[model samples]
Target: MEAKLWFILLCSVVALLLYVIGFWRRKAGEAAFAAARAAATAEDRDRYCRLAVMAGHREACKMFCLARSDFFEDHRPLEPFKSHGIKVVFYGYYYPSRYTDLLNEEQRAFCRSLYQFKEGENHGIGFFKACMSALKLDDAPYHIMFMPCSDEFKYARRFKRLDWYIRTHRKGRTSGLYDVDVFEPRDSLHEAKGGENRILERNYRITGDIKGKQVIIVDDVLTSGQSMADYKEEIERCGGKVVAAIFYGKTVSVPPMLLVKAVVWGGYIKTG
Candidate 1:
Protein backbone atom coordinates (compact mmCIF):
# COMPACT_ATOMS: atom_id res chain seq x y z
CA MET A 1 0.00 0.00 0.00
CA GLU A 2 2.87 2.37 0.83
CA ALA A 3 4.54 1.59 -2.50
CA LYS A 4 1.32 2.33 -4.37
CA LEU A 5 0.89 5.56 -2.42
CA TRP A 6 4.48 6.55 -3.29
CA PHE A 7 3.86 5.91 -6.99
CA ILE A 8 0.68 8.01 -6.93
CA LEU A 9 2.50 10.83 -5.14
CA LEU A 10 5.27 10.74 -7.73
CA CYS A 11 2.78 10.92 -10.60
CA SER A 12 0.97 13.81 -8.94
CA VAL A 13 4.24 15.68 -8.47
CA VAL A 14 5.19 15.21 -12.12
CA ALA A 15 1.78 16.42 -13.27
CA LEU A 16 2.04 19.50 -11.04
CA LEU A 17 5.51 20.25 -12.38
CA LEU A 18 4.28 19.96 -15.96
CA TYR A 19 1.39 22.30 -15.24
CA VAL A 20 3.71 24.87 -13.65
CA ILE A 21 6.08 24.75 -16.63
CA GLY A 22 3.25 25.19 -19.09
CA PHE A 23 1.87 28.14 -17.11
CA TRP A 24 5.28 29.81 -16.98
CA ARG A 25 5.82 29.36 -20.73
CA ARG A 26 2.39 30.77 -21.49
CA LYS A 27 3.02 33.86 -19.34
CA ALA A 28 6.39 34.40 -20.96
CA GLY A 29 4.91 34.17 -24.43
CA GLU A 30 2.17 36.66 -23.56
CA ALA A 31 4.73 39.08 -22.13
CA ALA A 32 6.85 38.82 -25.27
CA PHE A 33 3.86 39.48 -27.50
CA ALA A 34 2.84 42.48 -25.41
CA ALA A 35 6.34 43.91 -25.62
CA ALA A 36 6.45 43.54 -29.39
CA ARG A 37 3.02 45.15 -29.76
CA ALA A 38 4.05 48.09 -27.59
CA ALA A 39 7.18 48.60 -29.64
CA ALA A 40 5.19 48.55 -32.89
CA THR A 41 2.70 51.04 -31.45
CA ALA A 42 5.50 53.43 -30.56
CA GLU A 43 7.04 53.14 -34.00
CA ASP A 44 3.72 53.82 -35.69
CA ARG A 45 3.04 56.83 -33.47
CA ASP A 46 6.41 58.39 -34.28
CA ARG A 47 5.97 57.77 -38.01
CA TYR A 48 2.50 59.32 -37.99
CA CYS A 49 3.60 62.43 -36.13
CA ARG A 50 6.65 62.86 -38.30
CA LEU A 51 4.62 62.60 -41.50
CA ALA A 52 2.13 65.14 -40.22
CA VAL A 53 4.93 67.53 -39.38
CA MET A 54 6.47 67.01 -42.81
CA ALA A 55 3.10 67.79 -44.39
CA GLY A 56 3.25 71.24 -42.72
CA HIS A 57 0.09 70.64 -40.75
CA ARG A 58 0.44 72.87 -37.69
CA GLU A 59 -2.77 71.39 -36.30
CA ALA A 60 -1.17 67.95 -36.45
CA CYS A 61 1.18 68.92 -33.66
CA LYS A 62 -1.72 69.79 -31.40
CA MET A 63 -3.80 66.84 -32.55
CA PHE A 64 -0.99 64.48 -31.75
CA CYS A 65 -0.49 66.09 -28.39
CA LEU A 66 -4.12 65.57 -27.45
CA ALA A 67 -4.53 62.09 -28.94
CA ARG A 68 -1.11 60.45 -29.06
CA SER A 69 -2.02 57.65 -26.69
CA ASP A 70 -5.15 56.72 -28.60
CA PHE A 71 -3.37 57.18 -31.93
CA PHE A 72 -0.71 54.73 -30.84
CA GLU A 73 -3.38 52.14 -30.19
CA ASP A 74 -4.98 52.72 -33.61
CA HIS A 75 -1.73 51.98 -35.52
CA ARG A 76 -2.30 54.61 -38.21
CA PRO A 77 0.75 56.17 -39.87
CA LEU A 78 0.53 59.61 -41.42
CA GLU A 79 1.57 60.62 -44.93
CA PRO A 80 3.03 64.00 -45.85
CA PHE A 81 0.64 66.31 -47.62
CA LYS A 82 2.03 67.23 -51.04
CA SER A 83 0.55 70.69 -51.39
CA HIS A 84 2.75 73.24 -49.65
CA GLY A 85 0.51 76.26 -49.14
CA ILE A 86 -2.94 74.70 -49.18
CA LYS A 87 -4.59 73.20 -46.11
CA VAL A 88 -3.29 69.72 -45.30
CA VAL A 89 -6.22 67.44 -44.64
CA PHE A 90 -5.83 64.16 -42.76
CA TYR A 91 -8.29 61.85 -44.47
CA GLY A 92 -9.02 58.44 -43.01
CA TYR A 93 -11.40 55.49 -43.39
CA TYR A 94 -13.10 56.02 -40.05
CA TYR A 95 -12.70 58.15 -36.94
CA PRO A 96 -12.47 56.53 -33.53
CA SER A 97 -14.92 57.52 -30.79
CA ARG A 98 -12.40 57.89 -27.97
CA TYR A 99 -11.11 61.21 -29.38
CA THR A 100 -14.41 63.07 -29.24
CA ASP A 101 -14.40 64.33 -25.67
CA LEU A 102 -10.69 65.08 -25.65
CA LEU A 103 -10.59 67.70 -28.41
CA ASN A 104 -11.02 71.35 -27.44
CA GLU A 105 -13.39 73.72 -29.20
CA GLU A 106 -10.68 75.04 -31.53
CA GLN A 107 -9.44 71.58 -32.35
CA ARG A 108 -13.01 70.47 -32.97
CA ALA A 109 -13.48 73.39 -35.31
CA PHE A 110 -10.47 72.33 -37.30
CA CYS A 111 -11.63 68.72 -37.60
CA ARG A 112 -15.01 70.01 -38.64
CA SER A 113 -13.49 72.13 -41.38
CA LEU A 114 -11.59 69.20 -42.89
CA TYR A 115 -13.10 67.15 -45.71
CA GLN A 116 -13.61 63.49 -44.69
CA PHE A 117 -14.85 60.43 -46.54
CA LYS A 118 -16.05 57.05 -45.29
CA GLU A 119 -15.80 54.05 -47.64
CA GLY A 120 -19.00 52.15 -46.96
CA GLU A 121 -21.66 51.40 -44.38
CA ASN A 122 -19.78 48.39 -43.04
CA HIS A 123 -16.54 50.36 -42.89
CA GLY A 124 -17.72 51.91 -39.60
CA ILE A 125 -18.43 55.65 -39.74
CA GLY A 126 -19.78 55.32 -36.21
CA PHE A 127 -16.25 54.80 -35.01
CA PHE A 128 -15.28 58.08 -36.66
CA LYS A 129 -18.15 59.77 -34.88
CA ALA A 130 -16.90 58.33 -31.61
CA CYS A 131 -13.45 59.72 -32.27
CA MET A 132 -14.92 63.07 -33.14
CA SER A 133 -17.01 63.09 -29.99
CA ALA A 134 -14.03 62.03 -27.87
CA LEU A 135 -12.09 64.88 -29.43
CA LYS A 136 -15.07 67.14 -28.64
CA LEU A 137 -15.25 68.20 -32.27
CA ASP A 138 -18.47 69.46 -33.74
CA ASP A 139 -19.75 68.32 -37.12
CA ALA A 140 -17.71 69.69 -40.00
CA PRO A 141 -18.52 69.90 -43.70
CA TYR A 142 -17.42 66.36 -44.56
CA HIS A 143 -18.40 64.32 -47.59
CA ILE A 144 -19.17 60.65 -47.16
CA MET A 145 -18.53 58.79 -50.40
CA PHE A 146 -19.74 55.18 -50.34
CA MET A 147 -18.04 53.62 -53.32
CA PRO A 148 -17.87 49.83 -52.94
CA CYS A 149 -15.08 48.53 -55.09
CA SER A 150 -16.07 45.93 -57.67
CA ASP A 151 -13.36 43.63 -56.38
CA GLU A 152 -14.45 44.11 -52.78
CA PHE A 153 -16.63 41.01 -53.01
CA LYS A 154 -13.79 38.87 -54.24
CA TYR A 155 -11.26 40.43 -51.90
CA ALA A 156 -13.62 39.80 -49.03
CA ARG A 157 -13.81 36.12 -49.90
CA ARG A 158 -10.10 35.80 -50.55
CA PHE A 159 -9.13 37.21 -47.15
CA LYS A 160 -12.05 36.05 -45.05
CA ARG A 161 -11.24 34.85 -41.52
CA LEU A 162 -13.10 31.56 -41.86
CA ASP A 163 -12.89 30.55 -45.49
CA TRP A 164 -15.29 27.67 -45.87
CA TYR A 165 -16.08 28.66 -49.44
CA ILE A 166 -12.46 28.56 -50.51
CA ARG A 167 -12.08 25.12 -48.97
CA THR A 168 -15.25 23.85 -50.58
CA HIS A 169 -14.34 25.29 -53.96
CA ARG A 170 -10.75 24.07 -53.85
CA LYS A 171 -11.49 21.05 -56.01
CA GLY A 172 -13.24 23.08 -58.70
CA ARG A 173 -11.69 25.71 -60.97
CA THR A 174 -11.36 28.65 -58.58
CA SER A 175 -12.78 32.14 -58.94
CA GLY A 176 -9.35 33.43 -57.94
CA LEU A 177 -8.08 33.30 -61.50
CA TYR A 178 -11.18 35.06 -62.74
CA ASP A 179 -10.62 37.84 -60.24
CA VAL A 180 -7.09 38.28 -61.51
CA ASP A 181 -8.31 38.57 -65.09
CA VAL A 182 -10.92 41.09 -64.03
CA PHE A 183 -8.35 43.20 -62.22
CA GLU A 184 -6.10 43.13 -65.30
CA PRO A 185 -8.86 44.55 -67.46
CA ARG A 186 -10.33 46.66 -64.65
CA ASP A 187 -9.07 50.01 -65.89
CA SER A 188 -10.55 49.95 -69.39
CA LEU A 189 -13.65 48.04 -68.31
CA HIS A 190 -14.29 50.41 -65.40
CA GLU A 191 -13.81 53.38 -67.69
CA ALA A 192 -16.30 51.98 -70.20
CA LYS A 193 -18.74 51.19 -67.38
CA GLY A 194 -19.79 54.82 -66.91
CA GLY A 195 -16.37 55.98 -65.62
CA GLU A 196 -16.90 58.41 -62.74
CA ASN A 197 -20.62 59.01 -62.37
CA ARG A 198 -21.44 55.32 -62.97
CA ILE A 199 -21.31 54.34 -59.31
CA LEU A 200 -22.60 57.67 -58.04
CA GLU A 201 -26.35 57.56 -57.41
CA ARG A 202 -26.44 61.30 -57.06
CA ASN A 203 -23.03 62.64 -58.14
CA TYR A 204 -24.22 66.11 -57.40
CA ARG A 205 -24.29 65.33 -53.70
CA ILE A 206 -20.48 65.14 -53.42
CA THR A 207 -19.46 66.70 -56.74
CA GLY A 208 -21.36 69.94 -56.54
CA ASP A 209 -19.24 73.03 -55.82
CA ILE A 210 -15.87 71.21 -55.37
CA LYS A 211 -14.39 73.46 -58.05
CA GLY A 212 -10.75 74.54 -57.81
CA LYS A 213 -10.37 72.99 -54.33
CA GLN A 214 -7.27 70.89 -53.80
CA VAL A 215 -9.12 67.65 -53.01
CA ILE A 216 -7.23 64.88 -51.27
CA ILE A 217 -8.60 61.44 -52.13
CA VAL A 218 -8.29 58.84 -49.38
CA ASP A 219 -8.81 55.08 -49.28
CA ASP A 220 -7.80 51.97 -47.31
CA VAL A 221 -5.49 50.44 -49.87
CA LEU A 222 -3.83 51.23 -53.20
CA THR A 223 -3.40 48.17 -55.37
CA SER A 224 -3.96 48.96 -59.06
CA GLY A 225 -5.38 52.46 -58.27
CA GLN A 226 -7.84 52.07 -61.14
CA SER A 227 -10.68 52.99 -58.81
CA MET A 228 -8.82 56.09 -57.70
CA ALA A 229 -8.24 57.05 -61.31
CA ASP A 230 -11.94 56.81 -62.01
CA TYR A 231 -12.75 58.91 -58.98
CA LYS A 232 -10.12 61.44 -59.91
CA GLU A 233 -11.54 61.78 -63.41
CA GLU A 234 -15.02 62.29 -61.99
CA ILE A 235 -13.78 64.86 -59.49
CA GLU A 236 -11.87 66.73 -62.17
CA ARG A 237 -14.87 66.69 -64.48
CA CYS A 238 -16.94 68.16 -61.65
CA GLY A 239 -14.44 71.07 -61.44
CA GLY A 240 -12.44 69.67 -58.49
CA LYS A 241 -8.68 69.58 -58.57
CA VAL A 242 -7.08 66.28 -57.48
CA VAL A 243 -4.06 67.58 -55.63
CA ALA A 244 -3.11 64.40 -53.72
CA ALA A 245 -4.16 60.93 -52.68
CA ILE A 246 -3.41 58.90 -49.57
CA PHE A 247 -3.87 55.22 -48.82
CA TYR A 248 -3.10 53.08 -45.83
CA GLY A 249 -1.24 50.51 -47.93
CA LYS A 250 0.61 50.77 -51.27
CA THR A 251 1.48 48.51 -54.17
CA VAL A 252 4.67 48.51 -56.24
CA SER A 253 3.18 48.45 -59.75
CA VAL A 254 2.01 51.50 -61.70
CA PRO A 255 0.03 53.99 -59.64
CA PRO A 256 -2.49 56.41 -61.13
CA MET A 257 -0.64 59.57 -62.17
CA LEU A 258 -3.64 61.83 -61.86
CA LEU A 259 -3.27 61.93 -58.06
CA VAL A 260 -0.13 64.13 -58.49
CA LYS A 261 0.95 62.98 -54.99
CA ALA A 262 0.44 59.78 -52.98
CA VAL A 263 1.51 58.10 -49.77
CA VAL A 264 1.19 54.59 -48.41
CA TRP A 265 2.78 51.99 -46.14
CA GLY A 266 4.14 49.06 -48.19
CA GLY A 267 2.30 46.34 -46.28
CA TYR A 268 -0.78 45.83 -44.20
CA ILE A 269 -1.30 47.60 -40.88
CA LYS A 270 -4.68 48.72 -39.60
CA THR A 271 -5.32 52.40 -40.45
CA GLY A 272 -8.99 52.46 -39.48
Candidate 2:
Protein backbone atom coordinates (compact mmCIF):
# COMPACT_ATOMS: atom_id res chain seq x y z
CA MET A 1 0.00 0.00 0.00
CA GLU A 2 2.85 2.40 0.80
CA ALA A 3 4.53 1.72 -2.59
CA LYS A 4 1.22 2.30 -4.40
CA LEU A 5 0.73 5.63 -2.56
CA TRP A 6 4.26 6.79 -3.50
CA PHE A 7 3.69 5.81 -7.17
CA ILE A 8 0.39 7.76 -7.25
CA LEU A 9 2.07 10.86 -5.74
CA LEU A 10 4.92 10.74 -8.27
CA CYS A 11 2.50 10.44 -11.18
CA SER A 12 0.45 13.41 -9.85
CA VAL A 13 3.61 15.55 -9.64
CA VAL A 14 4.60 14.66 -13.21
CA ALA A 15 1.11 15.43 -14.49
CA LEU A 16 1.07 18.81 -12.72
CA LEU A 17 4.49 19.74 -14.17
CA LEU A 18 3.40 18.83 -17.71
CA TYR A 19 0.15 20.81 -17.33
CA VAL A 20 2.01 23.90 -16.09
CA ILE A 21 4.48 23.81 -18.99
CA GLY A 22 1.69 23.42 -21.54
CA PHE A 23 -0.27 26.26 -19.99
CA TRP A 24 2.75 28.55 -20.07
CA ARG A 25 3.44 27.76 -23.73
CA ARG A 26 -0.17 28.41 -24.67
CA LYS A 27 -0.18 31.77 -22.84
CA ALA A 28 3.05 32.82 -24.51
CA GLY A 29 1.74 31.87 -27.95
CA GLU A 30 -1.45 33.83 -27.35
CA ALA A 31 0.50 36.86 -26.24
CA ALA A 32 2.72 36.68 -29.32
CA PHE A 33 -0.28 36.41 -31.59
CA ALA A 34 -1.94 39.38 -29.94
CA ALA A 35 1.20 41.49 -30.33
CA ALA A 36 1.52 40.57 -34.01
CA ARG A 37 -2.09 41.46 -34.68
CA ALA A 38 -1.64 44.84 -33.00
CA ALA A 39 1.46 45.56 -35.04
CA ALA A 40 -0.28 44.65 -38.29
CA THR A 41 -3.21 46.92 -37.47
CA ALA A 42 -0.89 49.82 -36.72
CA GLU A 43 0.97 49.29 -39.96
CA ASP A 44 -2.26 49.29 -41.91
CA ARG A 45 -3.30 52.60 -40.32
CA ASP A 46 0.07 54.24 -40.94
CA ARG A 47 0.41 55.73 -44.44
CA TYR A 48 4.19 55.39 -44.44
CA CYS A 49 4.10 51.71 -43.66
CA ARG A 50 6.18 50.54 -46.62
CA LEU A 51 7.60 53.92 -47.61
CA ALA A 52 10.92 55.27 -46.40
CA VAL A 53 10.97 57.62 -43.41
CA MET A 54 12.15 60.59 -45.47
CA ALA A 55 9.18 60.30 -47.83
CA GLY A 56 6.89 62.02 -45.33
CA HIS A 57 5.21 64.39 -47.77
CA ARG A 58 4.19 61.58 -50.08
CA GLU A 59 2.80 59.66 -47.13
CA ALA A 60 1.20 62.75 -45.60
CA CYS A 61 -1.19 63.15 -48.56
CA LYS A 62 -2.32 59.57 -48.24
CA MET A 63 -2.89 60.02 -44.53
CA PHE A 64 -4.89 63.16 -45.21
CA CYS A 65 -7.09 61.30 -47.66
CA LEU A 66 -7.70 58.57 -45.12
CA ALA A 67 -8.53 61.08 -42.42
CA ARG A 68 -10.79 63.01 -44.77
CA SER A 69 -12.67 59.90 -45.71
CA ASP A 70 -13.06 58.95 -42.07
CA PHE A 71 -14.17 62.47 -41.23
CA PHE A 72 -16.73 62.60 -44.02
CA GLU A 73 -18.22 59.30 -42.92
CA ASP A 74 -18.95 60.69 -39.48
CA HIS A 75 -19.68 64.32 -40.39
CA ARG A 76 -21.03 66.24 -43.33
CA PRO A 77 -18.61 66.92 -46.14
CA LEU A 78 -17.60 70.54 -46.72
CA GLU A 79 -19.78 72.11 -49.34
CA PRO A 80 -18.33 74.09 -52.22
CA PHE A 81 -17.97 77.78 -51.42
CA LYS A 82 -19.21 78.81 -54.84
CA SER A 83 -22.61 77.31 -54.17
CA HIS A 84 -22.88 78.94 -50.77
CA GLY A 85 -21.56 82.32 -51.94
CA ILE A 86 -19.02 82.19 -49.10
CA LYS A 87 -15.68 83.91 -49.40
CA VAL A 88 -12.74 81.54 -49.79
CA VAL A 89 -9.61 82.25 -47.83
CA PHE A 90 -6.21 80.61 -47.52
CA TYR A 91 -3.90 80.80 -44.50
CA GLY A 92 -0.50 79.18 -44.15
CA TYR A 93 3.06 79.64 -42.93
CA TYR A 94 6.14 79.99 -45.10
CA TYR A 95 7.90 76.73 -44.46
CA PRO A 96 10.98 76.86 -46.70
CA SER A 97 11.32 73.13 -46.50
CA ARG A 98 7.82 72.73 -47.90
CA TYR A 99 7.94 75.04 -50.90
CA THR A 100 11.36 76.36 -51.87
CA ASP A 101 13.87 73.52 -51.61
CA LEU A 102 11.55 70.53 -51.49
CA LEU A 103 10.67 70.69 -55.16
CA ASN A 104 12.44 70.51 -58.48
CA GLU A 105 13.26 73.65 -60.48
CA GLU A 106 9.89 73.78 -62.27
CA GLN A 107 7.86 73.02 -59.16
CA ARG A 108 9.88 75.48 -57.12
CA ALA A 109 9.17 78.20 -59.67
CA PHE A 110 5.49 77.36 -59.65
CA CYS A 111 5.31 77.76 -55.87
CA ARG A 112 7.26 80.98 -56.06
CA SER A 113 4.72 82.41 -58.48
CA LEU A 114 2.06 82.03 -55.81
CA TYR A 115 4.38 83.22 -53.05
CA GLN A 116 3.97 86.90 -52.24
CA PHE A 117 7.00 87.41 -50.00
CA LYS A 118 10.53 87.07 -51.30
CA GLU A 119 12.71 84.11 -50.46
CA GLY A 120 14.58 84.26 -47.08
CA GLU A 121 12.36 87.06 -45.81
CA ASN A 122 11.51 87.29 -42.11
CA HIS A 123 9.23 84.47 -40.96
CA GLY A 124 6.63 86.88 -39.59
CA ILE A 125 6.39 88.71 -42.92
CA GLY A 126 6.13 85.41 -44.73
CA PHE A 127 3.47 84.25 -42.32
CA PHE A 128 1.44 87.41 -42.77
CA LYS A 129 1.65 87.21 -46.52
CA ALA A 130 0.75 83.54 -46.53
CA CYS A 131 -2.29 84.21 -44.37
CA MET A 132 -3.44 86.93 -46.74
CA SER A 133 -2.99 84.69 -49.78
CA ALA A 134 -4.74 81.80 -48.14
CA LEU A 135 -7.73 83.93 -47.33
CA LYS A 136 -7.97 85.10 -50.98
CA LEU A 137 -8.59 88.56 -49.55
CA ASP A 138 -5.45 90.46 -50.42
CA ASP A 139 -7.39 93.49 -51.70
CA ALA A 140 -10.41 93.03 -49.45
CA PRO A 141 -10.76 95.38 -46.52
CA TYR A 142 -10.56 93.23 -43.41
CA HIS A 143 -8.96 93.32 -39.99
CA ILE A 144 -5.96 91.10 -39.25
CA MET A 145 -5.69 89.35 -35.91
CA PHE A 146 -2.79 87.49 -34.36
CA MET A 147 -3.69 84.84 -31.83
CA PRO A 148 -0.53 83.13 -30.73
CA CYS A 149 -1.07 80.28 -28.27
CA SER A 150 2.53 80.43 -27.10
CA ASP A 151 3.72 81.99 -23.88
CA GLU A 152 3.43 85.79 -23.77
CA PHE A 153 7.05 86.28 -22.73
CA LYS A 154 8.47 83.93 -25.35
CA TYR A 155 6.33 85.45 -28.08
CA ALA A 156 7.18 88.89 -26.75
CA ARG A 157 10.82 88.24 -27.65
CA ARG A 158 9.81 87.21 -31.18
CA PHE A 159 7.50 90.22 -31.45
CA LYS A 160 10.32 92.49 -30.33
CA ARG A 161 12.57 91.10 -33.03
CA LEU A 162 9.78 91.52 -35.57
CA ASP A 163 9.03 94.98 -34.25
CA TRP A 164 12.64 96.09 -34.66
CA TYR A 165 12.83 94.54 -38.11
CA ILE A 166 9.58 96.15 -39.23
CA ARG A 167 10.43 99.54 -37.81
CA THR A 168 13.79 99.48 -39.52
CA HIS A 169 12.86 97.93 -42.87
CA ARG A 170 9.20 98.80 -43.53
CA LYS A 171 8.34 102.09 -41.88
CA GLY A 172 4.65 103.21 -41.64
CA ARG A 173 3.50 99.66 -42.57
CA THR A 174 3.16 98.57 -38.93
CA SER A 175 0.24 100.89 -38.11
CA GLY A 176 -2.66 98.50 -38.74
CA LEU A 177 -0.52 95.55 -37.67
CA TYR A 178 -1.79 92.48 -35.88
CA ASP A 179 -4.44 93.07 -33.22
CA VAL A 180 -2.39 91.04 -30.69
CA ASP A 181 -4.23 88.22 -28.95
CA VAL A 182 -2.91 85.48 -26.71
CA PHE A 183 -4.34 82.16 -25.60
CA GLU A 184 -2.50 80.77 -22.56
CA PRO A 185 -4.90 78.04 -21.46
CA ARG A 186 -2.35 75.55 -20.19
CA ASP A 187 -0.04 77.95 -18.38
CA SER A 188 -2.89 79.85 -16.77
CA LEU A 189 -4.37 76.65 -15.33
CA HIS A 190 -0.95 75.48 -14.14
CA GLU A 191 -0.38 78.78 -12.33
CA ALA A 192 -3.70 78.35 -10.54
CA LYS A 193 -2.41 75.04 -9.06
CA GLY A 194 -5.07 73.21 -10.98
CA GLY A 195 -4.72 69.47 -11.27
CA GLU A 196 -3.85 67.88 -14.59
CA ASN A 197 -7.41 66.60 -14.91
CA ARG A 198 -8.87 70.07 -14.61
CA ILE A 199 -10.26 71.42 -17.86
CA LEU A 200 -8.41 74.55 -18.86
CA GLU A 201 -10.44 77.68 -19.41
CA ARG A 202 -10.48 79.31 -22.85
CA ASN A 203 -9.38 82.94 -22.62
CA TYR A 204 -9.54 85.31 -25.56
CA ARG A 205 -9.39 89.04 -26.30
CA ILE A 206 -10.41 90.50 -29.65
CA THR A 207 -9.32 93.95 -30.75
CA GLY A 208 -11.80 94.31 -33.58
CA ASP A 209 -15.48 93.65 -33.99
CA ILE A 210 -16.05 89.98 -34.95
CA LYS A 211 -19.83 90.16 -34.74
CA GLY A 212 -21.65 88.65 -37.75
CA LYS A 213 -18.34 88.23 -39.53
CA GLN A 214 -17.14 85.01 -41.08
CA VAL A 215 -13.85 84.03 -39.50
CA ILE A 216 -11.22 81.63 -40.75
CA ILE A 217 -8.99 80.16 -38.04
CA VAL A 218 -5.62 79.18 -39.41
CA ASP A 219 -2.95 76.97 -37.92
CA ASP A 220 0.13 75.05 -39.01
CA VAL A 221 -0.78 71.53 -37.92
CA LEU A 222 -4.05 69.88 -37.05
CA THR A 223 -3.31 67.58 -34.14
CA SER A 224 -5.67 66.68 -31.28
CA GLY A 225 -7.85 69.68 -32.26
CA GLN A 226 -7.91 70.87 -28.69
CA SER A 227 -6.32 74.19 -29.56
CA MET A 228 -8.67 74.66 -32.49
CA ALA A 229 -11.58 73.80 -30.29
CA ASP A 230 -10.57 76.45 -27.82
CA TYR A 231 -10.12 78.99 -30.59
CA LYS A 232 -13.47 78.19 -32.15
CA GLU A 233 -15.22 78.60 -28.80
CA GLU A 234 -13.63 81.97 -28.24
CA ILE A 235 -14.35 83.18 -31.76
CA GLU A 236 -17.98 82.22 -31.43
CA ARG A 237 -18.12 83.86 -28.04
CA CYS A 238 -16.84 87.07 -29.59
CA GLY A 239 -19.63 86.81 -32.23
CA GLY A 240 -17.49 85.63 -35.11
CA LYS A 241 -18.75 82.77 -37.23
CA VAL A 242 -16.04 80.32 -38.21
CA VAL A 243 -16.50 79.84 -41.91
CA ALA A 244 -13.74 77.28 -42.11
CA ALA A 245 -10.62 76.00 -40.38
CA ILE A 246 -7.60 75.45 -42.62
CA PHE A 247 -4.48 73.52 -41.79
CA TYR A 248 -1.21 72.85 -43.57
CA GLY A 249 -0.92 69.29 -42.28
CA LYS A 250 -3.37 66.87 -40.74
CA THR A 251 -2.25 64.25 -38.24
CA VAL A 252 -3.74 60.78 -37.85
CA SER A 253 -5.68 61.58 -34.70
CA VAL A 254 -7.90 64.69 -34.72
CA PRO A 255 -10.77 65.36 -32.40
CA PRO A 256 -14.18 64.97 -34.00
CA MET A 257 -15.64 68.18 -32.65
CA LEU A 258 -13.09 70.44 -34.38
CA LEU A 259 -14.17 70.29 -38.00
CA VAL A 260 -11.41 70.76 -40.55
CA LYS A 261 -12.56 72.46 -43.74
CA ALA A 262 -9.49 72.03 -45.89
CA VAL A 263 -6.01 70.53 -45.64
CA VAL A 264 -2.96 70.86 -47.88
CA TRP A 265 -0.27 68.20 -47.61
CA GLY A 266 2.66 66.79 -49.62
CA GLY A 267 3.85 70.37 -50.04
CA TYR A 268 7.05 69.48 -48.21
CA ILE A 269 9.47 66.62 -48.35
CA LYS A 270 11.59 65.85 -45.35
CA THR A 271 15.17 65.95 -46.63
CA GLY A 272 16.50 65.20 -43.21
- Tens-digit lDDT track of model 1 for 1-272: 99999999999999999999877755554444334323345465445543443343333333344533333323332433333222122233222223545344444543343312122223323332233233332333322222233454533432232123323432321212121222311232222433433443222223246665545454444434566666666766767665545453322122232211122221112362
Best by lDDT: 2
Q: For each of the candidates, give the backbone clash count.
A: 17, 5
User: Global lDDT for candidate 1?
Assistant: 0.38
The TM-score, computed over Cα atoms with residue i paired to residue i, of candidate 2 is 0.36
Candidate 2 C-alpha lDDT tens digits along 1-272: 99999999999999999899877755554444334323434444332321311222333333333334454332221221221233322222122332232223433443343231212232444544443445554332232223343455543443444455545654332311244455453353212332224564545456566776655554443334555566667767878765555443332333332222122223223321
TM-score of each: 0.26, 0.36
lDDT of each: 0.38, 0.41
In candidate 1, which residue ranges exceed 4 Å CA deviation?
1-76, 81-121, 126-148, 151-218, 224-226, 243-272
RMSD of each: 20.4, 13.5
